[model samples]
Target: MPTAVQALCANFPDLTPPATLALRLEALMPSRRLPAGRVLFAQGQSPSAFYLVEDGEIEARFAALDGRMSVLEHVRAPRLFGLAAFISGKPSRYEAAAVSDSRVRVIGAPAYRVLMDDWPGFARALMREFAERFEGNLRLLEAARHLSAAERFGVALRQLADERAGPSDAEGWQALRATQAELAQLAHLSRQTVNQLLRAAQAEGRLRLRYGGLDIRR
Candidate 1:
């Protein structure tokens, strides 16, 4: 198998950086292996480095005063996270933790700046990532403003399914590996509401709940 950095670099096939730059980055940056449920960074902490998820999944989450945790984003492999704090020179607004066994490449601010200054491909890739995230956030805001709770739940489920769908069966059903609580957090709904919505969907033959996840019909 390719190394984590090699896999990450492969993601930007159209915006390939120079081999020298890629090698330099690989040499300079450090990789961290996080076990499932390990906290990579905590909310309110200073950003020492931004991360690129090279393997597995990392969840960005917010903790309320009452100890309720809401997931803001589920970042999968070959994606970047923690950039806003790194760029703005501010503390992180939310925590990031490994949702599964994961490996992440840590890029310090100095190295990031150097790459941005020297590598046009790297700079363009970052800009593209930022633009896509900004557009997605805008869509989410619009959904929250206009959609009902059930509608929002459907939207969230579809999004998660798109992101992490397993192999489809002969009947065109795809499995999503997520819990009701995680879905609740993602949809910004209560667990009870999620359960009700899930039951309704199942009753309608839209999905089937399994031991650890759900299978949704296409």
Candidate 2:
């Protein structure tokens, strides 16, 4: 448990100093791994652990009524996830799957509870993580709710713009790993509609679909 802190100090972007960071991290987290396409957790599954990405990437995918996979978001190394269910004692809202080979820290409910009581700094970190997830989830819901298809398409571009503009020094843009079909499900439209929208955006210089993924200039 104690050594866990050192790993966090090295792994986390927001890590503080060594000893204190180590003390803050140790015992509060547990590490695990999953292969590509492996399900780390599933929607409607009971929450037993919260996850923090240490390496590799994960996709937060929601299953549609028609049994389609809609990727809500991608979580990369150093990002945090799975905590929302832990905190709420509810089933997962999305199925978390490894996008590639991955490693993560699982903060069990008991350990998280203990740390929140005994370690102020670690508690703050945990709370901050939870807050981030809450806000992001809220934003996603709000954008999707009460919107027509065209409005949803507009929201998607705005989201792409925001994601692509994030700190290059922090990490390169979030991988545009989403397929056109996934975008269609997310936007509640057909794949052909998504392609048309993408082309329109591209022609307007709002975005460019590169080999790896789509690029948003704005």
Candidate 3:
């Protein structure tokens, strides 16, 4: 069986490092497994390590004053996160938690910077990943600002499906692993509104509620 680092390299073929570089990365970074619901970091905390998720789900969330938590993003495996605070040299604006049992490779900010400086390929890949995430966030903000509640939720469902879908069939139908509350939070809608939209989609054959989550059909 392949190691977590090896598996991550294989998963992101475009970002794979040469053997020597890969070995160096494995030596520099350490991997950990977290149980579901584990708080990886809290909002307003200072950054210590940036994580590259090797497996399972992770979410970034912001908690409102009334104790409501809104999800900012759902991250699947072979993805880097918890970097914005590290890059800005400031406290984190959101918290990260394990949505399921997860494995991740962690490197401190100083070491991460050293790796980027020493490996051009790694640096470029990291930069590209950051740029793509920034663009996605901007699009989400636009949808929230201009789209109707139902339309915004439609966008959220599609986005969740895309995130959870396998690489070979990303555009195909998939199940959502999130709860209705999570979905509502991400879409900026109330749970009652989310339920209404989901029921409407079900009537149209776009979604089906399963025991675990919603089964969506594209």
Candidate 4:
């Protein structure tokens, strides 16, 4: 079996750490398998461990009134989660859960700091990833401020379709495997508005509302 460092290196080939940092990571990181829908951490929880997704998807979300959820991010393999709290020395900003059965490497804050100190590449990679997330959040904030609900829904569907499309399926119809409520939360809209938007799109042949999700077509 691969050591923790080796597994991390394999997952993130471009962000290879030096020998000393690798040793430290191996000592500090432990792998865990999470079943689908497992809650990794919750909002307001004290920060202890950050995670690297070895396989599958993790969702970071905020719980709202009436039990609704607003998605913060969807993290895939080779990506890190819970870093915002780790860096800020605050409680977790959002709850994290396994979106599918997933393997994750749990790294404590101390080890993460060591890696950041000793591995320039690793630090750079983390910075880049976090920066992208920040930019995405900023865009979402801007969209919520200025865009109509319909426009936000359209943008959300197009983006989700692109992310799910395979190379062969590119330029063809695409499916979004999220419920209407989930899509509404992600797009910062209400379910009623989401339904209206979907109905309009379906009428125009731009998309079809399915039992669980949406099928978007060009």
Top candidate, metric lDDT: 1
Candidate 4 residue-wise lDDT, 81-182, digit = tens: 788787778888689999899988888977877877877777777778678767777666667778888778765665455444333356576766766775
Worst lDDT run of 10 residues, candidate 4, spans 159-168
The C-alpha lDDT values of all candidates are: 0.81, 0.67, 0.78, 0.76
Task: Put the candidates in lDDT order, highest first.
Answer: 1, 3, 4, 2
The positional error of residue 123 in candidate 3, measured at the CA in angstroms, is: 2.1
Model 3 poorest 10 in a row by lDDT? 165-174
By TM-score, the better pick of 3 and 4 is: 3
lDDT (tens digit, per residue) of candidate 2 on 1-218: 22555444444446454344444555557678799999988999977887767778888888889997776776775566777777788888789999899988887866666556654466677677667656755665666787776677766555544433343333243335345765665566788988888888789876668775665543
Per-residue error (Å), model 2, residue 35: 1.1
The RMSD (Cα, Å) of candidate 1 is 2.7
Clashing pairs in 3: none
Q: Write the per-residue lDDT of candidate 3 for residues 80-190, one digit (tens) a residue.
A: 898889778789999999988998888786558656776558777777778888777776777789999987897777777766743333645566676788778778889
Pick the winner on TM-score between candidates 1 and 2: 1
Off-target runs (Cα >4 Å) in candidate 3 are 1-4, 167-172
Better of 2 and 3 by TM-score: 3
The pairs that clash in candidate 4 are none
Q: How accurate is candidate 1 locally (lDDT)?
A: 0.81
lDDT of 4 at 176: 66
